[model samples]
Target: MKVVLQRVKSAEVQVDDVSVGQIAQGYLLLVGIQDADTVAEIDYLVRKIVNLRVFEDSSRKMNLNIKDVSGAILSVSQFTLYAQTKKGNRPNFMHAGKPEYAKEMYNLFNDKLREAGLLVECGIFGADMQVNLINDGPVTIIFDTDSNY
Candidate 1:
């Protein structure tokens, strides 16, 4: 499991020229699921994301979590996060989980986020989506279950 999170003033997702999901003053998440990912990884990430203190406080310090600012979440499936590009010119997606399995994991991830008390919006699991966002502070972060960083 891995997620790329960006603090956004606002974000929206569209599929086939129709709005699917959107959020205001929150984090936009690009989520990836591996074949080996399970509930444990999802649980860990949900806790970390909700508690991340990247929002600015009165002292101009990044001291507030999403919950403190009543922020929401916009999660999108992105299997490309697992793309293997070390070989030839073309990237290989062998490490990306099988579609059906990945969808299950993706759904579980969003469900966990909502259970953490944050409003959550999501793009279709396997649809072609166009995302728009006003990045806040351009504060981007990555959380991956396979890495210590």
Candidate 2:
């Protein structure tokens, strides 16, 4: 599992010209799943994202978590996050989970986040999506289940 978390003032996702999901103020999460990902990975990532203290507090310091700020989440399935370009000219997707498996895990991830009491909106899995966002502070972080970063 891998995730790119971006703090955003607002965000929306569209599929086929129809807006499917949108958020007013929150983090825009681009999620990726790999073959080795499991329920444990899902659980860990959700906890970390919700509790991440990237949001600024009264002191103007990045000390508030999403839950504290009452922020929502716009989760988008993004296999490209796992694109491996270390070797050849062409990117290799061998590390990315197959579509069938990836979709299943992606759904579960969203469910887990919702269960954590955070308002979670999501893009349609396996669909061609267009995402728009105003990145708050342009604060972005990349996370991997394997702690690669």
Candidate 1 residue lDDT tens string, 19-128: 99999999999999989998999999999999999999999899999999999999999999998988898989888899999999999889889989999999999899
**Please, what is the TM-score per model?**
0.98, 0.96
**In candidate 1, which residue pairs get closer than 3 Å at backbone N, Cα or C atoms, i.e. clash?**
none
TM-score for candidate 2, please give it: 0.96
- Local distance difference test values of all predictions, in order: 0.95, 0.93
What are the per-residue Cα lDDT tens digits for candidate 2 across 21-114? 9998889999999988999999889889978999898999999999998999999999998888989899888999999999999999999999
Clashing residue pairs in all predictions, respectively, total 0, 0
RMSD to truth, every model = 0.7, 1.1
